[model samples]
Target: MKITVILCYAMFLGACLSFLGGCASGKSSASRVEVTPFSCVLAPDTNGSVCVDVVFRVPSQYLSRRSRLIIVPQLLLDGKLSEELTPLVVDAPIYAKKMYRRKVVQNYQDPYDAYTGKVEGVSGGLELPYRETLTIPLGVHTGCVQAIVTEDGCGGCTGLDTVEVASVRNLASLIQDTFELVRMEPTFHEGKVEVLLQFLINRHEIRSDLGNNRSQLKKLAGSLRPILADTLTRVGDFRIYGMASADGSRAFNTTLARKRAESLREWLLKELDIHPELYTRMVVDSRPEGWLPVYQAMVDDGHPDSLFVGQILRRYPGSDDDVQEQYIRRLSCWKDICSRYLQKDRKIECAYTYTSYESVLATDGMWIPFPIKQMEANNQAILCLRRGQFEKAVDLLKDFVHYTPATMNTLAVGHFRKGDVKSAEKLLRKVKLPEAFRNLGVLMALQGKWYEAYRFLKGSGSLNEAVVALILSYNEEAEAIMAELSDQSPLAEYVRALVTSRLGDDVAFEVHLKNACQLDELRLRAAGEPDFEKYREDKIFREIVK
Candidate 1:
C-alpha cells in the first residue's frame, strides 16, 4: 500500500510539472534581480519634483518556464507607500502563449496584466533589463525605493507568490529647525540740553531772585541729574554764551557779556561739580544783542513801530550790533521793546552735549529695553522684529537712514521670518555680516535649496548649520558640529537625535530623542518626523512620544 501511494505521488508531481511547461533545472532565486544606486535618495530637482535613476537587471533563467514575473517599483515615505512606478512584466513561452490566446482569440482583456514593458518567450534562459527615471513631488523628508516581485503560475498549477526583491534606504528630506537670533551691539547716541538765565542790566553776577532765573536753573539741574546718574552717559561740550541788551555801548556791553558768561560758568562748576578735565573743555563766549530781537518782539506784540524797526535792521544788515542798536533806539516803541523782549536776550545761556551708550535685552523671540524704559526708534523696531511684528519693524526701518550693519541684518531676519523671501534676500545681500550669511543659509534651506544652504551655513558653528549638514548627508560633519554645539535646549537635543540616527547609533538616538520629547511641541514633532519613523514602533520611542 505504501509503494502504491509513493508511485501515485510521483506521477501527480510529474503531471503538474509537465502541465506547467516543464520547470527549469536551476532554482529560482530573488538574488538574481539587481537594483542600481544601492542608497536610494530622493533629491530635490529644479522641476519641482524629486527624481531618481533606477535600473533593474534579471539574470538568465531567473523566471520559471510557465510563470509570469511582474516587478513593481515603489517609493516609500516613512515606511508607507507613497508612489508606484509602471510595472515591468516577463512571461515564459507557455504563459505568454496563453495570455495571447485569451486576449486575441477569446477577445478577453485582463486589467491585472497592466505593465509598461514586457518580455515574452523567455525560452528558459532569457535575461531581462529595465531602466527608467522615476519622479515624485518634492518636500518628502525621508523615503526609500523598493522593488516588489510577484509570481503567477501557469494554469493554477502553482500558487501565486509575492516578495520584495530589492530596496534602498536612508532617504533624505528637508529639515525645519530653529535658527539663530543675533543680538545688537551697544550704540552711541547724542543729546543736548540748554538753559537760559536772565541777568540784570550791566550786571556780571547772576541774581537768583530776578526774572525766572531760579526756576530755570533748577530745571536745568534736574535735566542734568538723570544724564549724570547713568554711568553710560558722558557729558561734554559745556558752553555758556552771554548776550547784553542794546541799551549800552558796544564796548561796554561786550565786556559785560563776557563777565556774565564767566559768572554762570563758575556757578555751574561749583554746583554741578564739573570735573577739572570737563571744566577745561568748557567754552565761554559773549555777544551784544543786535536789533533783531527788538524787531521780533515788537512785531509779535503788534507795536506801532515794529515795521520801522524791521526796515532799519534790514537796511543795515551788515552793520555791527552798535550801529543796529543806534538805529533801533530811534523807534517810538523802543522803550517798550526793551522792557518786553530786550531783557529776554540779556541772558546767560548754558548748553551741553552728551553721548549715551544704549543697549537692549534680546531673547529668543522677543526683545525688551534693558532698563525697562522707553527706547529710541531703532531699538523699538528691533523689539518689534523679535516679537514677530514684521510689518511694524519694516515700517520703522524703511525710511530710517542711520542703519548699522546689525540693524540691517535684523530687518532681513524680520522679513525672512515673515515669509517674505524676496525682500529678505534683497536686504541681506546688502548686509556684510556673519549673521546675515547665517540668515541667508536658513532662507535657502527653507526654500529647498540645500546645496546653497550648505555653502552659506558652512563654518557658522550653529545648530542650524549642523541641521543643514545632516540634511545634505554630511553625517560626520554634522556629528562633529553637534559635539561642538553648546545648546542644551529641547530643539538642540532633537537635532542631536537626528544626527545620531543617521550615523546608525541607535542607542544614542533613543537617549537624545527622549530628552527632547520632554517638551510637548518637540514630542509632537517627533511623532510625525519621517527621520524617526523607523523608531515609531520602538518601545522606548513610543513611550517618549506618548
Candidate 2:
C-alpha cells in the first residue's frame, strides 16, 4: 500500500493524511494512527526551567511504513504561545515487515531541537501500543499554560491528529511567614490566705482578742474596708467554715459548730462595722467533724500507738457513725489525741478572696493606671509600646530618654519584635530578669537555634515559650505551659497540631488542624508552615490547608 498525504496549514488548523484502502504492496491502508488525548504537568526546576510532562499513546497497528509518526507539541501560556518554548518533536516509527507480526522492541531517542531544547522519552521508539511519556524542559513561566500536541505522519508531510492538553500544576508553593511580636508588660500576682480564729470547747463567746489575734482581726476588718471602698482592693468571695472537734454527740457538736460560725460572722459584721450597703455575700457553713485533720495528725505523730489509731480508723468497717467514733475513742491514746489534734478544730475558719490593685502593663504595653498621668515624663515610651509602634518605642528609650532595667528591657522587646534580634540580645545581656530569659528564648527560636532556645526557655511559663518548646519537640513542657494559658488562639491551635504531628498522633493532628483552619488567619498561616510539608499531599491535610 502507498500512503498519500494532503498538507494544508490554515491559520492554526492541523493537516491531514489519506491512504487508499488497497494496494499491491501488501501493506494495509486500514492502519491509521490514533492519538489519545493527553495532558502536561508543569513543574518549575531550580535552574529556571519549567518541566513539561506529556503522556499519550498510539495503537499497535497504527504505524505504517509509509508514514513516519511524530508528535509536535507547542506550549500555550496565558492564552498565547510562549516565545521561549520551542516546539518539541515526539516520534514512534515501525518497519514495514514488522507490521504483520507483534514483537518486543525497545528504543530510546533524545531528539535534539534547533533551539537546543531537550525532551526526555522512554527507552523505545514509539513501540506498538505507543503509550509513552515525554518530559520536555521548557523555559520557566508561571502563567496559566497548556500544551497543543499534534501527531504528524511523514514528518510535516501529513498531519494525523491534534489535541489541546489539559493540565494539573505541581508547582512548589512559596512560603511567606508572618511573625507575632511578644509584648513586655508588667504582671500582677494574685493570691489568697485563710484566717483561723480558735474558740473554747462548747463556747461561741468572744475571748482572747489580744496579741496577734487582735492584729489578725484588725487586718481582716481593714482589708474589708479597702475592698468595700473599691480603691486598692476588690473582694471576690468570703467563706466562713465553723468546724467542731470530733468529740461529744454528733447533734451537740453540729449545733456548737453552727453557733461558732454565726458568732464569728456577727462579730465581723457588728464590731468591724462594715457599711451595711456592701453587697458582699459570705458563704457560711459548719462542719461538725472533719476527719482530714485527725488523719493528718496521726500520720505526722509517727508514734507506735498512732499506727494502731490509723489502723482502727481505716479498718473500723461499720457504717454507723457513732460506732466508728466510739471505736476510735476506746484507743489508749484517746485523751492525748483529743487534746492535741482536736483543740485546733474548735475554730471559725474565714476564707476570703480579694484582688489587690497594682498597675501592670496591658497588652498594648501601656500601664493600666488607677489615675492618668502626663505622658511627657515616664509614659512617652510606654505609649509607643502600647500602640505597637516599636520603632518609636526604641527611639524614645534610646540613650538619655530612659535608663532603667525595665526600660531597657522594654526597649529590647520592642527591638526584637521589630526584627532587630542582635540589638535585643545585646540589651538582654545587660539585664537579669525572668522576662529577659523569655525574650531571649523567643529570639533564639526565631533564629532556629533550638537548643539555645530551650536553654533560655527552661523554667519559663509564657505562651511564646510554649510555642518554642513545641517547635523544638519538647512535647511535655509545651503541654504544661499551654495548659496554663487562659486564652487559646488560632496560633496556639496550630502549634498544638504541630506537637500532635510530632508525637505521631495523626488523629489528634487532624483534629487540631481542623480547628486551626476554622480561623482564617491560621489556615493561611498553616499553608506557609514547613512543619506540615509532609502532610501537604494528604487529602485531609490538603483540604485543611487549602
Candidate 3:
C-alpha cells in the first residue's frame, strides 16, 4: 500500500513540473509579424490621421501562415489610437492637407490628391493582390494603421513605435507635394505651348523672328493635339479673346492689333477646327450716352461719354492722356487711308492701317478662324471616345487626367458621346465635383442634351447656380426665372423670378417676378435681356419683369 501511494505522489509532482516548464518557455515573442510592401507615414494632418498602405508581403524568412500585420502609428497629442478610426476611401491621387487651405482648394491644387494612401479591411483578411484607397482625415497629431489580416487576440498592434517624426512644409516642398507624379494643369493652359517655345524669347525680349519657330510650333502643336483633344472633350465654348500690347501710333497699333487677331485666327483654322479659347472682359453698354448731371460727373472723373467714344474713334490706346487732338488728327488721316482700301477691297499689311472695333468686326474678324491650329492639337480627343473606343479613350484620357485633374467632364463627355451613356453617368457619380460643373450644365443645354442639362444643372452650386439653372432648365421661358426674384437684389432675384414665372411654376414665379421689378437691378437687366422679348410684348410680363 505504501509503495503504491509513493508512486502516485511522484506522478502528480512530475505532471506539475511539466506544466511549469511549458509556461516558462512560452513562444509568444517568437510569434512573428511581417507586413511587406508597407508604406511608412512620416507626417499626419491635424485630424490625427495618416493612412497606411502596406501590402502583406509573404515572408521569405518564415512562413506567414500564423502571422498578422503589426502596425505602429504614433499618437498626435492626447492619448489616441487608430483602432476605431476610418479613413476616406477613393481611387484618385492623394493630397496632404492642413486646415487652412481647404477653403480655396480649387485655386490651389487639391493637396490631398497629391497624397497617396491605401485602404484595407479592418482586422479582416482580404484576397491577395487587392487595391484600395483610404482617406484619413487628420486630427492634431496622430497617424493611422490598419491590418489586412485578422488578429482578434494578438497584442502586436497595440502600441506606437518609438521613433522621431520628421515633417517639411515650405513652398518648394508644397509644390513637390502637389505634383509628385506630374502636373496636368498645363494640359489645358497654354503654358505647355509657352514652355515648348521657351526659345522664342531672349530671356524677356521677343527676338527678331527666330527660324526655330517653325520646328518649335510643329512639335508643340503635334505633341499637344491629343492633349487639346482630351481637354476639349471635357469642356465647352472655346472662348477666345486677343489683346494687343500697349505700343505704336494709333494707325500702326490698330493695324498690328488686326494682324495679331488675324494671325491667331488663321492658326486656329489650320489646327483645331472646333476647339477655341474663350474671350473675356469685353466692354459692352452703359447707361445712355448723355445726361447733363451724369455727363458732368463723368467729365469731372476724367471721363465723358463723347470723349470716351472719341478716343475709341481715334483708335487711341488708353495709355496716353495728353494731346488728344494730335492723336485724333493722326487717327483721322490714317482712317481715310484704311477707308479707301476698304472701298476698293484692297489689302494693307499691319503697321500701316488705323482701325476700330466695328471696322475689325466687319473685315479681319471674317478671316479669323474659329479654332486655331494651336488649339486643335489640344482638343479633338473625342473622336475615338465617341466611336466607343474606351480603352483608347481611357489611355489618352488618363494621360490627360494625370495632367489636368479638374477636367472630370472629359470622361463624362467622352463616355456619353461614345454611346456609353451609362458609363459616363456612372463615372461622374463617383466623385463630388466642383462648382465648375455649372458651366457644363449650360454647355449641355446648348448641345441639346436636355436630360444631361437638367442633371448637371440640378447638381450645381447651392444658391446662385441652382436658381440660375432652375430658370434656364425650366420648360417655359421667364416664368421660372421671375418666380425666384426678390425686391432686395434686383439682378439676382428678379432675373430668377422672371425665368421662373415664364417657364416654371407660374404662380410661384409671377408673385416673385413682380417683386423683382420693384427693385432697380432687375429693371436694368430686363431692359437689356433678349430672353425677355416675349415678356416685353406682354403688358403683364413687362410690368412684372421691368
Candidate 4:
C-alpha cells in the first residue's frame, strides 16, 4: 500500500511539472510577439490626425490554456509616452471561461473585459492576429509605436513584456513653416486735354493774335509738351474739328472748314515738331457751326430777340444748313447775330487722349517696364518693400509726409520683413487698410497663432493667407485660395504643390512641384520638405529635388 501511494504521488508531481513547464514555455519572450514592417511612418491624415498602421501577430502555441495575453499599443514621441491606444486582450480557454463566469454568474465586471477576444479550446494551439490603425492628434514630430503585453494566470498577473513594434524617425524635416510676402500692385491712369482757337470769318489760316489765340495756343502746347517729351506717354486718340458760320454757303463753308482743320494740323506738326508717324495718328475733321452758337451768344449778351432767334433755330431741326439759314435771315436780329455770334462759330476745337505708364518693382528687386510720371517717395518705398530691400524701404518711408493707410501698411510690411515685429505691429494697429489686415495675418502666422491669422487672412486672396490655411490643416480652403491666385511665380507654384500634396492629388502635386523647382531655392527646400517625404523615392520627385 505504501509503495503504491508513493508512485501515485510521483505521477501527480510529474503532471504538475508538465503543466508548469507548458506555462513557462508560453512566457518565453523569443518570437512570442511578431510585428510586421518594423519601420513605420507616422503621417498626417487629411482629417488632421497623425496615424500609423500596424499588424500584431502571436505565434501558434504562444498562450497557455490557463493564462490570458493583454496587449496595449502605445505611441512614444521623442522617447516619452505621448498616447495610449485601445488595449487588445486575448483570452486563453481557461481564463476566458473564468471571465465569462465572473460576468454571468458572479456579476463581476473588469474594465478591460470589453476589449477581450476569446480563443476556444486550447489557447496555446491557436495563433492571434490583431491589426489596428492607431491615431493621435497632429504635432508629434518623431515617435515610435510599442506594444505592452502581459501574460496572466486565471487569478493573477504572471509575466510582463514591452516590445517596440514600429518606429518613426526624421519627421521634423517635413514641416513647411515659411511665410510668404505680398506685393503692392501698380497703378494705372488715363487723361484727356482740350484746346480751342478762333479764326477770321473767311479765313482758314491760324492767326496768333486772334481772340486770345496766343495764350490758348501756349496752353495747348504746354499740355502736349510733357506727353510728347515723356517716353512713357502714349498718344492715343486726337481730333481737330473746324467750325464755319451759317451765313456762308454750305459748299463754301465746307471748303473753309476743311482748310481750317488742315491748317491747324499742319501748324501743330510744325510747332511741336511732331514725328511723321505721330502726325499720321491725328484726326482732322470739319462741321458747320449752324445757328446754335448765335443763339448761345445772344443769350449770354441778354439780347431781347434771343428767345425769338432760339425759336427759329429749333423750328428747323435736322434741316439742311440752307433751310436753317433762310429761316434765320428773316428774323429781325439776323443782322446783329451775323455781326456778333457768327464770329464765335468760326473756331477750331481739339481733343486729345493719352495714356501714361507706371513703373512696377518686381519681387526680385528688378523694375518692370511701364512709364512712371515721377516716383513718389512713399511709392518708391513700397517698391523697395516688394523687392525685399526692407531697410531701404523703411528709410524712405521714415520721413514721408503722407501717413495714408496704404503707406502705413507698406511701412509695416517693411518693418515686419526686417524683423521689427513690435514696430510692425504698432504701425499695423494704427491703420484699417485691407493690406494691413493681410500683413497682420502674416505676423500671426509667423508667431504660430494659426486661428488668429486665419481670421485676418480669410478672403484676403494672398499667398500668405493660403499658407496659413495650409498650416491650420484646412487643405480644401488652402487649395481654393491657391487656385484663385493669378500669380504664376515659382513661389506660387510651390504653394500649389504643398496644397495638392495635402489634398492627396499626387498628379497635381508632381506637376506643380516640378514647376516650382525651376528655382534653386525651392528645389533645395523640396529635398527636405516633410510633405514630400513620402515621394522622396518617386522617380519624378527625386529628379525634381535632385
lDDT of each: 0.67, 0.55, 0.36, 0.71
Whichever of 1 and 4 has more lDDT, that candidate is 4
Candidate 2: which stretches are off by over 4 Å? 1-144, 149-192, 210-212, 218-234, 270-280, 288-292, 317-321, 352-365, 370-546
In lDDT terms, how accurate is model 4? 0.71
Per-residue alpha-carbon lDDT of candidate 4 for residues 214-295, written as tens digits (9 for 90 to 100)? 8877987787778777776677778887776577688788788878889988988989888788899889888777778778
Candidate 1 lDDT over residue span 1-546, tens digit each: 999999999999987875465433323465356655444444543333544555655556556656777777776664688778767777766677777899998898766576623566454344445555655455343356677766575444433333343332222333443444455434444554555767655567877787787887888677766765676677766677877657668788888888888887788778777677877888988866666766777788888778888788888886777887777777777777667766553556666777665643332223443422233455777778768788887776666444555666777777776778798888777766787788788777767787898898899878777877876789899899989989888878988998888778999998899999888767765775656768879888888888
Clash pairs of candidate 4? 61-124, 174-530, 357-371
What's the TM-score of each model vs. the native?
A: 0.53, 0.41, 0.19, 0.42
Q: Of the pair 1 and 3, which is ahead by TM-score?
A: 1
Cα error, residue 545 of model 3, in Å, equals 26
| Per-residue alpha-carbon lDDT of candidate 2 for residues 99-184, written as tens digits (9 for 90 to 100) | 22332353423243232212233222242222223232332223333333333334334444544443322222211122223333
Top-scoring candidate (lDDT) = 4
Cα error, residue 133 of model 2, in Å, equals 27
Candidate 4 vs. true structure, TM-score: 0.42
Q: Give candidate 4's error at residue 43 in angstroms.
A: 12
Write down the worst ten-residue block by lDDT for model 4.
169-178
